[model samples]
Structures are given as structure tokens and as C-alpha cells.
Target chain A: MTERAVCVIGTGLIGGSLMRAAEKAGRAVWGTSASEDTAAEARADGFDVTTDTDDALRRAADADALVVLAVPLPVLPEVLRRVDAVAPEVRLTDAVSVKVAVADAVARYAPRARYVGGHPMAGTSESGWSAGLAELFVDAAWVVAADDGLDLDVWRDVAELAWACGARVVPAAADEHDLAVARVSHLPHLLAAVLAAVGAGGDDALPLALAAGSFADGTRVAGTRPELVLAMCEGNRDALLGAVDDALGRLGAMRGALASTGGLTATVFAGHAGRERWAASRDPKGVKVSLKGRAPLAALRAVGRRGAVVSGWKA
Target chain B: MTERAVCVIGTGLIGGSLMRAAEKAGRAVWGTSASEDTAAEARADGFDVTTDTDDALRRAADADALVVLAVPLPVLPEVLRRVDAVAPEVRLTDAVSVKVAVADAVARYAPRARYVGGHPMAGTSESGWSAGLAELFVDAAWVVAADDGLDLDVWRDVAELAWACGARVVPAAADEHDLAVARVSHLPHLLAAVLAAVGAGGDDALPLALAAGSFADGTRVAGTRPELVLAMCEGNRDALLGAVDDALGRLGAMRGALASTGGLTATVFAGHAGRERWAASRDPKGVKVSLKGRAPLAALRAVGRRGAVVSGWKA
Candidate 1:
């Protein structure tokens, strides 16, 4: 197989990291930034980058190259338009959060190009080229959203790109990806933002002083670039809103349970069991939450009767 | 001052850690557990523990000793009653989450003892004696709730105990402590629980596989011992409920703001600024969120006028 050339547009944290990962995979990697200063910084950091968007597209117009749109969601349509006009033959992909919108945009503007929508489930509460690390995608889940007319080979290329970055590739449809991420990622980010806002809006600085590991870890993502968070929430508004309602319903049930002694224990136990199972599967290096070996069906039935359901509990 | 002995009434994670910290601080430490198995485990782990509650209280009846009630809130009153009846001469303190309730209980039952309310902000998802570590409380905030009639020496003893464990002692009134922790700690814990429950309750195992660092960190405490989380939430139900309302209101506003292109950015930015300030104040080793060195008043006014009032913004 010939060496694959990878081009990432927008040299921010995700983009810069992808470039570095592609380079580490022995692929020829190039990057483009929205601003001259950012482009210069990326170049200074040993990335082959340019500030000229058109010029960047021209260089990546090769049919064998994978052109990754790494910009935020709101600007994706415009980026797609530019890419389709300048690099129509190149196979396309993205590292954007929301899939449906990107999938739709790619379908409308870049119909000829085989575009695979992807979201790498990895990032820090930091951004810009300076925050990028080559190991950012290690052991992370990279979701590849299937599009209707996309070729199988293009999907395989996206998966290969993710694997090259040490990521586990997860195949999902556009809507399925959105719904799943809304439950796991988007809703949690908004919830963290709300918690941060509440703590920050409290009287005096006592709330801040009392905020410990739980608060720090909970609100960590809320401290990310504000515009970035807003874009993500806005992009996946429908699914996120639905997830918020689902969570609020769960919380309401817990509140009702708290009204009676020992009622809340059922919910807490269910959450513990659920989280332990989920945690065990996701990251072994993370805090190991032990669960006594029990049949999944029995655990599921028990928790289901208790009015809570965990993912792995189901067959 | 003569070396003070410490007696911990429970050999779970918090109690065991307190015992270890006390021992490391050159204090003779003793502990009790409700279960013989747990007591035996504690003993195996080098803890001087007794399964008999009566004998544990009897051994801790020293006038110069500090008796720490490190148990669940549901059984806190019962433990206080036992201590009052068996060890009233001892200076009393507790490692409970809710301060107001514990203070009231101490007043009602252990009035003769020098009772001070202390809450150590430190833990891992794992619990029990085996999970306890001596360094658990290092650099953590230990809130010592102020009482009207508690002796100055008693307060000093609590502070000294926290310092001996390498904790920063934060003096706060009972109601104040409850309110602060409700906004910062309790509310976030429940929110994490809700997120965990939602992820667990999703249709497929895709959400679990796609769960990333944010979800992992956000739900870290959700995997803790179920009964403990229940006790903490139920113990501070009123305050936590109020905080939940506050957070929901903020989330509702953010949801509404998402309808407009730039509206949600205000809330996101406010959250970012608030969390940055809160994070900087809590943990020095934590990531420093730069705020452009502008006057805080201006920053506050800017965000407050934008309709989201972060604590740092509410002058």
C-alpha cells in the first residue's frame, strides 16, 4: 500500500493532535489554521501548516489523501463548501462532535467525495495548538458515523486513521452516534456547566473553598473554551435536550425516593453497579469499581425491578 | 500539650483513613465497626478495632481523647447517643457530610461532650477498610463547623487533628457549611449519579463503549458505596434540593439560550470564569485557568449583565 497523506484543516487541539498522531503513524501529515499566528505557532511546533485555506486544500487535493475537517461544528458547512470546491476528489472525514449535521452538510455540499463522519472521544479542558498532545487519542473511542452513500473503503480508511492514532474504532449510524453521545458526553458536559454555574453563583467564596475532587472532576469540562462548549451543545440540541429530560426524570425519581427512608438506597446501588460495569469496560487505569461476580440477567432484573437499568446488565 | 489519642467509631474508608492519619500524627488510634468481618479486616490491616460497639465506646471513654464519629448519617444519632451515654467526658467530633443535622444531633444527645462538626473533603470511589490510605486527607479541605458554645480548645483540637492529617482546616458555621457543600459537593454528586444512571439506562452498550474521560471523571463518585451516597444525599436533602433547583434553573436558561446563535456563549463563558476562579482557590496543583488579569469587578459586571451570574461575577 502507498503511504497515505493526511491533511487536517484547523490546527487546534484536536487537529494538531491528529496531525501529530498521523506523523507518528509514518504518514505524511499537513495542517491548516484559521489564523496566521496559529499557523505560525503550529509550524514552529514542527507541524507542516499553512494559514491559506485555499492553498491548504490545493495541497490536499490528491485522490489518495484523507482531508480531515477538524474545525468546530458551526463552521463545518462553510468548511465543507470550501473543501468541495477546492479538493473535490479527496476522501473526506472530520473530528467534529455532532454527526447528523456534519453528515447532512457533507451530503449537500460534497456529494462526490466519500466523507466519513467521526468524533474522537478524547480531549482536555484546554484548546489551541499549544494544548495538543500526540498521545491524546490513545485508548480513546473514535466513533465513525456511517453515511448512506459513503463507500466501504472510505469507512475503512477512517477506521484505519483512528487505529493508527491508537483509538478503538466504533461504527455507528449518524443518528445513533448523536443519541449515544448525547447521553454519555453532551448531557454530562451541560450538567457539569450547570453545576459549575451554581457553585460559582453561590454567596461568598465558601462554596469555592468547599469544592473538592468531586466538584473539580465534575466541572472540569465546563472550564473548557466557552465558545467550544456552546457550539457542541447547540449542534446536538435535540438529542441533548432529550437526554436532559431523561436525566431530570431520573433525578426526580431519586428526589421522590429521598422522601422515604431507604428509598434512595435502591437508586444509589443501581448507579454504583451500573457505573462499575461501565468503568471496568472503558478504562482499566481509572479507579477500579469492583462488582461481585453475578449473572448479568439477575443483576439486570434486580435493578430493573428497582426502576434503574445499566447498559451491560442487558443481554 | 500532651499527645491526644483518637477513637474512630467505624472502620470504613473515611474512618480507617482517619485512624491511619491519627496514628501517623503520633496519636494512639482505636476504631470500631458494626460488622465482625469488617473489624477483623481492619485488625488485619493493623487497626486497633473492636466489633462490640459497647466495648469500643468503653475503650474510648478517656477524658483527654478525641472521639470521632466516622459513620453513616442515618446511624449518626444512634452513635452519638451511645457515645454520650458511654464516653461523655471525651472531646467529640465527626466526619459527616451534613453539618447542620450533625450539630443538632450533637446538641440534643452529646451536650455534655465537647462536640465539633468536621467534614473531610477526600475520598475515592472504592470504600471499606482495605481501600483506606493514610495520605487520603493530604491537602484536602477539612471543614470544621462552628458551634455557639463549643470550647475554644475543642475547636483548636479539631483544627490540630485536621492539620495533623495534612488537611487545610476551613472554619464555617453549621448552616453555612451545609449550604456551601450542598451547592458545591452534594449537588455535583447527585448530578454525576444522574449522568451515570442515564448512560447506564441507554438502549445499547454503545454509550458505555463511547464513554470518555469526561463521563469517567464526572461519574467517578457514582461508583462509591451506595448506602453512603444515599445517607449523604438524604442527610442534606433540603439544601441539596435547593441546589438542584438552582442548577436546573441555570440549565433551563442555557437550554433557552441555545435557540439563539450567541446566547449560550454567555452562560458558557460565565461557567468557565466561575469554575476557573473556584478551581484556583481550591487546589493549587490544579490547572490554572487564565482570566486575562482584568479586574474581577469588570468581569463580574460583564457576565452578570449577560444574564448569567457566576459567583465571581456577583459582587
Candidate 2:
């Protein structure tokens, strides 16, 4: 099978990295950035990058390339409008942090696009084209939305792209993806922000000075660009609100236990168990699903539900 | 002056590391552990480790060595009683995580001892002597309680001990240190526990599979031994309660904004600013304090309040 050419929109860290990874995987790849300076930088680096989103889409449409939307959440609508105008029937996916939001926006603005939402669970705190790396997605879990009635053809295209970039595919419904990420990703980001603020908000700088590894690790994500964090966090507000509520409930229970009984056995043990569960889930045994098999979507979702990842497709 | 001999009363990670660091710094160091197995292991490693706390304290008294209480919070009272019986007047200090609790315990159990509370702000999740590294305290902050009326002679001994362990001195009042660590250390531990439990508490394991660096870092401290976490967090209940309340307030406000205005602008910006402040405070300009000067305690406290670390003492 001929590899699908990848046309990545918004040549920032994620998009630029995807373009590089796809190219390195022997797929023809090009990208466009909203920032002319970013496009110029990528072009100067010998990548086929441009500021003309419409032109890139036109070429992608002509070549039947896989189009990956890599813009931040706040600009999804504007980018979707352009996708709608230039390549409404293109094979489309996204690298946006939030899936349901992007799915809804695509339904509203680019209804004809064969869109399969995706989020590669990978990145550094750093951003911009300069921080792009071909290996960013290596060994990362890349979520491809397996919502009902999705285009299997486009889904395969996106999955192939992820696999080509050395990521394992974890098929999940768009809503499920949103909720899961809210717990693991979005909530952590918010908590980090709060932790950072609390650590620095003290009258004396003693807290900041005395902060060691826990403080550094717990608040690491707070160093991410505020605008980017705001976009992703606020975009998944509903799911994140639920996650935040769950965390607050736990915190309240913890405080009450500490105040009354002077014991954190429940909280600490529960957390340790949780961390153990996570550790056990790492480097999970690889599972394969034939895309042409009966109930491929069901199989994929079942694998994901069991915390298993599709390392690759089976013949 | 000749280096004071060191007697560490608990040969676990921090205590064992301190013994190694002190010995490496040319101080005569010996240690005791509540666990005979650990003591035996240290003894096998060619260190002077014993399971007899009273014997260790008696020897420390004979040599007029620094008595470093390296036991957990729960066992501190018992250890202090031994100190009262065997070495009540020895130059004393502690390596407890919570200073106020240790100080209060020392006052209650060994009131005649010239005690100076201290905490080396460094550790790993692993415990026992096997995990101890001689370089563990190198470049780490060793906080010595600078509360008023402290024995200047013992204070110098503790400060010099910290320096001998290749750590910089951070002078803070017991109450101030408790509050500061409540915000920076204990609170992060609690938050990490909550985060780990929440991430693992999901009905499906998809969240765990999708977990990335943010989730990993946020919950890293949750992997620490539960007993240790419980002892430190519960030992400093009053201050930790305040920190937990502060975190809950920030989380509540963040949720409210996300739900109402769909904007995390304020929270994100505040967190970003906090992280930036922390980054700015790293590798701060070295400052010196004269241990023999007038109002040295006041000078140390002033330096600590300004987030300046005492890298060394002036003659």
C-alpha cells in the first residue's frame, strides 16, 4: 500500500514533530503554520512548510493526503472553517488535547470531512517548531476516537499515521477519551497550576526555597505556557469539572481525616495502590486487532478498556 | 575547630546517608537503627551501626558528639526518652521532616538537652541503608531551626554539620519551617496521593494507559512509603490543614471559573507566574552569615526570609 502523504496544519511543536516523524517514516509530509515566522523557520529547515493554509489544503485534497489539525483548542473553529472550505471531504484527524470539543466543532463546521479525532499522549513542556523532534511520539499512546459510525477508512489512515510515527494506538470513543484525559491529563495540569501558585504565594520565599523534588515534579506542568494550558483545560471544561470535583472530594476527605483522626491511611494507601496499578500497566503485553475483522471497533474499545494498547495491526 | 563526632539514631535512608556524608567529610560518625536487620546490613557495610539506641546515645554523650535523631515522627518520643536517659545535655539536633513537632517533643521529653532542630530537605522514595548515598546531601538545603533563644553553640554545631554534609544552611524558625513545608512538601504529597488514587479509581483502566509525563510527575511522590507520608503529614496537622484548605480554595475557584466563564486565565496565569518565580529563585546568589557575629540568629532568619541560602559561614 502506498503511504498516505501527511499534511499537518499549524507547524508548532506537535504538528511539526508529526510532520518530521511521518517524513522519517517514508511518507511525504508538509505543514503550514499560522505564524509566518514559524513557517519561514520550518521552510529554512528544508521542510515543505507554508503560511497559506488554503493552498496546503488544496494540495492535500488533490493528493488525497491525511490532514492532521494541530492547532490549539481556541483556534479550532477558525481552522475547521478553512478545512470546510478547501477540503471538506478530506481524511481528517486532530492532535488537539480535547477530542469531544474538536469532534463537535468538526460536526458543526466541517460536516463533510471524514474526521477521526486523535490525541497523541506525548509532549514536552517546550513548544514551537524549534522544539519538534521526530521521536516525540515513539512509544507514546496515541488515542484514535472509535465513536460509533466513524469512517473505518479514515480511522485506519490515522492509526497508520500514528503507527508510522512509532506510537501505539489506543482506540476510544471521543467522549471516553475526553473523560479519561480529564482525569489523567487535564486535572493534573490544573492541580499543578494550583500547587505552583500556592508554593509561590507565601509571604516569605522560604516555601519556594525549601521545595524539593515533590514540589518540582508536582508543579512541573505549571511551567507550560499559560495560554496553551488555558486553551486545553478550558476546552474540556465539563469532563474536567467532574475530575476537579472528584479531586476536591478526596482532598476534603483527606483534610477531615487529618483534622479528626490524624490519619491519612485511607488517602495514602489508596494513592499508593493507584500508583502501583499504573506501574503494573506500563509496558503492557501488546495486542493486535485485524481492522477487517468482525467488530473491529468493539475489539479496539475492549482492548483500550482493559488498558491494553494496539502495538500494531494484525494481518 | 576539630570536627564534632556525629551519632545518628536511625540508620535509614536519610540517617544512613547522613552518616556516610559526615564520615566522608572527615567527621567520626556512627548510627543506630530500630531494625536490627537494617543495623546488621549497615554493620556488614563496615559502618558503626547498632540496634541499641540507648548505647548509641551514651556514647554520643561521652564524646560530646552531635546527637541526630533520625527516627520517624511516631517513634520520636521513645527516642527522645532515650536521649533524656543517656545524653540529655549533649549538643542535640534532629533530622525529622517536621521541626516544630520534633522541637516540642524534645522540650517535653529531654528539656535539659541543648537541642537544635534540623531537617535535610533531600530524600528518595526508597528506604533502608542500601538506598543511602553518601552524596545525598550534597548541594541540598539543610534547614536548621532559628527560633529565638536557641543555643548558639549547638546552632553552630548543627550548621557546621550541615556544611560538613555538603549542604547549604537554611535557617528558619520552627513554626515558619512547618508552615513553609506544609505548603511545599506535605501538601504536594497529599495532592499526589489524591491524584494517583483518582487516576487509578476510574472504572476503566484507559486512564492509566493514557497517562503521560504530567500524570507520572504529578503522582511521583504518591509512590513513597505510606507510613512515612502518614507520619510527616499527620505530624504537622495544623499547618498541613491550612495548606490543604488553601489548595482547595484555589481548586474551587478554578472549577468555578471553568464552569461559569469557561476561562482558566487567572488560575493558569497565577500558576505560570508562581512557576516562573520558583525558576527564578533557583541557584540564587550565595550569601554568607557570620556565626560569631552579634544577632547571628536574626541575620540567619533574615537571610532565610529573603530566600537566600547560607552556602557557608564567615569566620
Candidate 3:
């Protein structure tokens, strides 16, 4: 059988990781980088890399070829315009962290192309091609936009690509995806950033120096690129604001309970119970993976677990 | 030189870990558990354990002997009273999360005993004796209360014990330790709890299921024992409240910036810079470790690094 051809634009962390996953899936993969240096690096790394997005899309304009627009949210509209003008026949997808904004951009600028809005739930604080790892998406959930009018074949191919990356595909509408991430992803970033700032507010370095595992783990994400975090938060501003309000209400209630009762009541105990329950409910056995041949460091293991990359679980 | 004898009350996670660390440090250690089952478990696990705290303290009442009170903050006063009546001659210390309250309790009930307040900055979410490890405090900072009127010999002995347990002794006054932990530790706990509660507040399980590494990392502390979290927060009420306000103010400003300017400006960039600077400035070489003999996992390592238990750093 002929392997599927895939093209990824913007060879940053997410895009580069996706290209690596596509290669792992035995697909003919191509990628484009905004910086010539990064493009050269990707080529040196044995990837078909290009400096121009239009030229890259032109190469992927073959029958049934998939074009993944993996740029940041702010640049999505312009890229959509370019794709519409250059290669509207190519089936398109996205890997932006924010979904609704990208979906809107796609509807406005690339209405002629068959598009599937997607977000691969994977990343480290580091960015760019240098930070990309082949095992990044292993056991992670890749969200596919299951909006009305999205072609069934396009959705299936996207799911196949996610599986190729050793990721489980979760189907959600654009709005649902945005809101879910706002609560879980975006809200946590804001909290960590604020916590980091507060820790530094004090003059003596004892607080930071004496910080152990909890503080390190808690503030790790706050060290990510500020511009990227800001863009993701602003792109999903409404959902993020609502999440912040919810969090504030919860914090205020806890403070009130502490003041009035001097202890956490069963009301606050629910958080502990809920978190444990949620943690236990994660089933690593949900994905069925079978290796086609002897693959290097490939596995169906969940993301963040050791040896997950070498587990080599393939659908 | 003969090994320094140490006794630990309340053989839970922290206490059990201390006992294990003391044993590794070549100290003759004894432990007491609140329940017969825990005492039996401790004995079965090769610890010198008993159900009577008073009896255990009486056995360790020799001159220069140290007793570590590792009970929860709410129960600390009662434990101090028992220690005073049974072993007033034993140099007493504690491993509570909050310091000011513990210091106050020691002053009130165990005034005759030479006392020091100590808090080891290490723990996993799991609790009880079963989770104890010999290396739990390795490479971790153990805060020794540097309050006025503390006996010089008592302080030296306590610092010696901290170094024995593969920990770096960080000298901090009661209030300073309380305030620093309030910002870095207690406030983060409240944020995690609220974030967990808010994430679970939504009816859809999708948000909870889709929670990735950042959400999981940020909220890891929320899964800790709720009552313990409450006690820590309430024990350092003033500082935690102040931290809460500071955090809320920072969060509010960020939300307003996103709403008004539609992007993160330099103001928000402080968090990123502060987090990075904090991460980069960590000096693993700050602690100087010297081992008298070959420890089982002996290596020149910083606390929190791999195999820190045998590093055996003395300050």
C-alpha cells in the first residue's frame, strides 16, 4: 500500500514533533520553517524542509496529500490566506493550542479546502525544531474538530496521523476543545506564572533556594516563552476569563472556610477526592498498539512515562 | 565516634522517612506510631517502633539524645506536653510544615527542654509508614529554626542530625521559615486545590480527562491529605492570606491586560523571567558533602538529585 503523504508548516516544537511522528507512521513527510536556519537544521536532520510555506504546500498538492498548518494562533489567518491562494485542493489541518480561533480563521480564509481543526495535546516548555522529540505525542490525546461539514475522510486521516504519532484521538467541537483547554491548560499557566512572580516578590532568596520538588514542579511551566503563553491565553480569552473566575471563586471559598472554621471541611475535601479519582481513571490500556516492524524507541506508553518512546505502539 | 541516638514520634511518612534517614546516617534510632497497626508495620519494616510516644521518649532521654516530633501541627501541642513531662532533658525538635505555631507550642509546653524548630522540605503525596524511604530527605533542605535563646549546643546537635539525614541545614527564624513556605508551598497548595475543584466543577469529564502534564504537575499537591493542607494553611494564616492576596492581584492584572490589550505585555513577562532566573540560579554545588566510608549509593550529588541519600553533606 502507498504510504500517506503529510506536510507540516512552521517547524517549531509541535510541528517538528508532528513531522517526526508522521515519519514514524511510515508516511512521506515534509516540513517548512519560518527561519532559514531552522529549515537548514531540519534538512540536516533528514527532513524535507523548506523556507517558503507556499513552495512547501505546492509540493504537497498531490492527490490526497495532507497539509498541516502548525503555526501559532496569531499567524494562522495569514497562513490560511496563503494556503487558499496556493493549494486549496490539499486537505488541511492545524495543530494550534487554541481551536476556536483557528477554526474561525479556516472558515473565513480557506473555505475552499477540506479542513480539520486539530490540537495535539503535547509540548515541553522548550520551542523550535531543536526541542522536538519523536516520542513527544506518545500516549497523548490529539483533539480533532468534529464540526459540521468536516469531511469524514479528512477526519479519519487526521485520526490516523494522531495514531501514527502514538497519540489517542479525542473528538470535540471547536468550542468544546477551547473551553476544556482553557480550564485545564491555560488556567494552570496563569497560576504558575503568578506564583513565580510572587515567590520572587520577596527580597531574601531563601524562599526560592529552599524550594523543593513541589515548587519546582509547580512553577516549571511559567518558564515557557511569555509571548506564546500570552497568545494562547488571549486567543481563548473568554473561556480563560471564565476559568479564572471559577478558580477565584473556589480560592475565596477555601479562604473563607479557613477563616470561619480554621480547617478544610468536606466541601474542600472534594477537591482531593476528585483529583485522585481523576488520576486513577486514566486508562493506559485504552490504545491498542502493534508494531509493523522493528522500530527504534517506539511504544504505546503514555506521555511522561519512561521508555514510552521505545514501546513502539502502532495502530 | 558513637552514632547519635535519635527518636521520632508519629511514624507516618515524614517520621518514618526521618527514622530511615537517621539509620542510614549510622544513628541509633527509635520510632513511635499512634496506632498499633502502624507500629506493627514499622516493626515489620525493620524499624524500632512502639505505640507509646511517652515510652519511646523516656527511652531516648539520655543527655545529647535528640527527639524529633513529626506529628501534624494540630496535634503538636499535645505531643510537646507529653515530651516535656516524659523527656524534658532530651533536646527536642519538630518536622512540621509550619514553624511559628510549632515554635509557639514548644515554648508553651516544653519550655524546660532545649528545643529547635525544623521543617524538612520534602514529601510525596502518599502518606503513612509504607511510603517511607531512607533517601527521602537526601538533597532536600531541612530548615532549622534559628530563633533567639535556642541553646547553641542544641542548635549544633539539630544541624548535625539534618546533615546526617542527607539534608542541607538552612537556618531560618520561625517567622522567616513560615513566611517563605507560605508563599512557595502553602499558597501553591491552595491554588492547586482550587484548580482541581474548578476543573471538576464542570459536569463534562472531558476537561478532566484531557488534563495534560502542566495541569497534572500544577495540581499534584491538591491530591495530598486535605486536613493536612488545611492545618498548614491555618498554621501560617497571616502569611498565607497575604500570599493569596498577592497572587490574586497578579492574576487580576494579567486578566485585565488580556482583556484590554489583547496580549501579554512586559508586565506579564516578569513571571517568565523570574521563573527562568530562578531555575538557572539553582546551585547544586552549594552543598558540600563528605562521606567517612563508602555509602551504598555514595556519590557527590546535590539534594533532590539522584542517590542523594549517601552524599552525606555536612555543613
Candidate 4:
């Protein structure tokens, strides 16, 4: 396979990690960022960084493959416009959290770009050039969401990149990606955030010391940039609404079951069992959590390269 | 500062750990059990074990000392009955979960035992004769629940032991202890158990490999003996019920907040902050989580033992 000039927008945790991963995989990597300072920092970090979307677009215009809109959800449509205007001939993909809105937005703003909506079902609380690590995507999941009209090789190229980045490639439609994320990532973020708010809210002296590992790990994602989570929740509002309701509805029902002291006790145990499964996805060596047992090839996920195995204390 | 004979009924985790702590403290550690086999094991484990409640009664009859009912909550009333019948003149304590039930039952069955319901907020998923660790109560929280009529010295003695074991002593009324455990311990257990059951009962192919550190650590205490938790929930039904309701209520509010996605508003950030403080409680250092910052002391309350810090890279 010929090497491709891959353009990564944002240059933060996800995008920087992808640039680092692609560069590590020997792909010619380039970047753009929302801020000139961030773009300069990426340049300092040794990537060919630019805040000029047109320059980034020009760099990948002749390529058989490229990544556009490798940024936050709110700015995706603008990123798509810039890329499509300059790199309309290139095959395209995105790494957005909620794909439906972005996909719809892309269709409106960049209908000519051979765009395939994609979401790497992974990330960390860390951000920026400093957070980049090459293996961030190892064993993690990347959901590929695209309709049948795109060229077959384009889909293959994106899936291949995900695999090369050590991510498990799962195919889904745009809406399905939104739904799944709302259930898995978005809802959990909200849950953690609210738990933090109410559990420790407004108290002059927060006696949070009683909380153990579970609460911390369970709510870890909440401490990240609140704006990011808000975008995700809002971008995928309908699905997120359904997912939140599902979680609350299920928990409510479980409480009722426990109230009876008997009956189908399966639901109660099921929730814990799911948590047990999610917890086991750690990088055996570094502490990064890998989806489907493969670690991401992204640099950002490698910050906690020496991961915590809480149960590592074997008797 | 006088050594005295203390009878520990139910030679299990709480009883055995207490027996060991007491013996190490140079006190007469006498223990009993409903089963002869366990009593023998307790004796073999270096305790002065006895099945004779009458002998224990004789031993404590003339002293201002400690006697612990380290039995299950459901069985506490009957055990307290036996203690009343044979050792009615002794000062007593217990390591049981449900305070209200045990207190009410003790009032009915062993009014003369000077009983103060206690729960050493310490445990492992493993139970039985071998699960007791010397440092089990060390740097752990010991909830001392008492009514108004109790002797302050008796409370002091129990607090001293917990402190000797490197524990933080927290005073709580019966109802207070019940509610607190429901919030911090019992509710988490039930929730974890329920989640575990769900996972175990589901698609057998759910890779336990994906069950990384977070899920495992979070659910560590979930897989504990079901009967123990059942007894707790059943015994402290009122408080546990209220906690479960509270938990579900929190989950519900969180759900609504997440689904609405009115941006990364202060409401969401509040949750994140609350969780951050709560997650700081886990101190995975030498011998104590509750002993986070405390130096080796004999009778101090561990202030740093409760908060669990979450997210970010480090704890």
C-alpha cells in the first residue's frame, strides 16, 4: 500500500494521538488546530502543524485517503467545509463522538468530499500535544459509520487505519454510533458528573474521603472538560435521552426488585457484571484501558502507560 | 489499663480479627461460636476459644470489660439471648451491620448485656475462618453506635481497640450508623452485586478479559457472601430501603441531567467536582485506606480515610 498524507485537525489528545500513531506507523502526518498557539505547539512537538485549514487541505488534496474533522463535535461542520473546499477529491473520514449530526452536517457543508463518518470509541481525560502517546488506540474500538455509496476502498482504508492503530473496528450506521455512545460513554459521563455534583455538592467541607476506588474510577470521566461532554450529550440528545432513561428506569426497577426481597434478581447482578467486564480492559503493561482487548496506537492513551490493576494484589 | 476477659461470639472475620487484636493487646481473648468446629479453629488460631457461655459469663461477671457478639445480624438476637441467659452481667458490643434491628433485638433479648451495636467498616469478599487478617481493622473505620444510657468508658474501650488496630473511630447513633452504611457501604454492595449478577447471567461470551481494573475494583466487595448482604438488607430494611431509594433517585436525576445536555452547565460540573472529592478516599498504601495521612496512633479518628479521588492521571 502506498503511503498517504493524513491530515489531522485539532491536535489535542485524540487528534495528536492519531498523528503520533500514524507517524509511528510511518504515514506522512500533518495537522491543524483551532488556535494558532496550539498549532505552533504541535509544530514544536515535531508534527507538520498548521492552523491553516487550506494548507492542511492542500497537503492531502491529491491523496487517495485523508482524515478531516479530527476535532471536537461542535466544530466538525466548519472543519468539513474547509477540507471539502480544498480537498474535495480525497477519500475522507472523521473521528467524531456523535456521528449523526456530523454526518448530516457534512452532507450539507461538504457533500463533494468522499466522507465516511467514524468514531473511535475511545479517549482519555488528558488533552493536548503533551498528552499524545503512540499506542493510544491499541485494542480499543473504532466504530465505522458510513452509507453504501462511498467507495469500498475508502471504507477499507479507514478500517485498516483503525486496525493499524490497534483498535477493533466495529461497523455501524451514524445513528447507531450515537445511540451506543450515549449508552456507554455519554450517559456514564453524565452519571458521574451528577454524582459528583449531588454527592459532594454545595457542602462547605466535602467529606469525600469515604469514597473508595469504585466511586473515583466510576466518576473519573466526569472531571474532563465539561464542554466536551456537553457537546456529546447535546449532539446525540435523542439517543442520550433514551439511554439516560434506560439507565434510570432499569435502576428504579432494580430497586423495586430489591424492595420485594425476591423475584427475578437477574437485573441487579447484571449491572455489576457489566462493570466487571469494562474494568478488565486494561493495558496489561501500561494502565491504559483497551476496548476489545487491543490497545489504541494513539499517544494520548499511553500517558498512564503503567496502568493500575487494582486486583493485581493477588493473595 | 487493666487486662480483662472478653468473650467474642462468632469466630469469623470480625470475631477472629478482634480476638487476635485483643490477644495481641494483652487482654484475655475468649471466643465462642454457634458451631463447634469453628470454635476449635479459633482456638487453634491462638485464641482462648470456648463453647461454654457460662464459663465466659463467670469470666466477665466480675469485670468492667468488653464482650463482642461477632455474629450475623439475623442470628444476633438469639446469640444475645444466650449471652443474657448465661453471661447477663457483662458489658457487650457487636460487629453487625443492621443497627436498628440488632439494637431492638438486643433490647428484647439481652437487656442486661450492656450491648452497644458496632460495625467495623472493614471486610474482604472472602469470609470464613481464613479470611481474617490482623490488619483488617487497622486504619479502618469503626462505627460505634450507642444509646444514651450506655457507659462512656465502654465506648472508649471499644474505640481504644479500634485505634490500637490503627482505626479511625466514628461515633454514631444506631439510626445514624444504619443510614451511613446504607449510603456508603450497603447501597454500593447491592448495586455491585446486582451489576455482577447481570454480567454473569448474560451472554456467556462477555469477555472477562474486558473486565479491567475499574470494574473489578469497583465491584470488589460485590461478590461477597450473598447471605451476608441479604441479612444486611433484610435486617436494616428501612435504612437500606431509603438508601436504595436515594441511590436510584440520584441515578434518576443524573439521567435527566445527562439526557437534557443543557451544555456543560454548572450542574454537570458540580457532579464532577463531587465525584473528584469522593474518589480521593482510597489510600492504597501500607496497611490502611482510612489511615491516609495519620501517623501511627493508638486512639485518633482518621480524617483522611474516607475520600476517594478520581479521574485525571494519578489518583
Best by TM-score: 2
Candidate 1: misplaced stretches above 4 Å? A44-47, A259-262, A283-315, B35-48, B51-63, B259-262, B283-315
Model 4 ranges with Cα > 4 A deviation: A1-5, A201-210, A213-218, A255-267, A272-315, B1-6, B20-30, B33-65, B190-225, B247-267, B277-315
Per-residue CA lDDT of candidate 4, range A158-269, in tens? 7667766777655555664565565555655665565455445422221243343334444566677777766677777787777666656666776776678643245534
Candidate 2 vs 3: which has more DockQ? 2
Candidates' chain A TM-scores: 0.84, 0.97, 0.87, 0.81
Top candidate (lDDT):
2
lDDT of 2 by residue, A1-315 (tens): 459999999888899899899999999999899888998999998899999999999999999999999988878899889989999999999999989889999999999999999999999988999999999999999999998778889988998999999999999988899999999999999899999999999998899999989999999999998878878888888999899999999999988998899888999999999999999988866787787857878878888999888776676
Candidate 2 error regions (>4 Å): A293-295, B291-294
DockQ of 3: 0.30
Task: Flag regions of model 3 displaced more than 4 Å.
Answer: A1-3, A266-268, A284-315, B1-3, B266-268, B284-315
Q: What is the lDDT of every predicted structure here? A: 0.75, 0.91, 0.77, 0.62
- In model 4, the number of clashes is 67
Reported per model, the fraction of native interface contacts reproduced equals 0.60, 0.89, 0.53, 0.34
> What ordering of candidates by DockQ runs from best to worst?
2, 1, 3, 4
Give one digit per residue, the lDDT tens place, for model 3 in A177-295: 78889998998888888888887777666677667776777888888888888888878988888898887777777667766776656544777876875686466334433423332
- What would the per-residue lDDT of candidate 4 be over residues B1-315, giving only the tens digit for each residue? 445556677878878887777777667667777678887887787777777766775676666558888877767766777778877867888888767788888788888766666777777667776677777877665666645666555655665666666665555567756665555555666555543443333222222322323234445555555566666666666766776676576666555554455444665667666665655534522222221232322112222222211111112
In the predicted model 3, the residue pairs found to clash are A297-A309, A297-A310, A298-A310, A298-A311, A298-A312, A299-A311, A299-A312, A299-A313, B139-B303, B139-B304
TM-score of 4: 0.79
Q: In terms of DockQ, which candidate is strongest?
A: 2
DockQ for each model: 0.32, 0.88, 0.30, 0.23
lDDT of 3 by residue, B58-112 (tens): 8888545788899888788788888889888678888999888887888798889
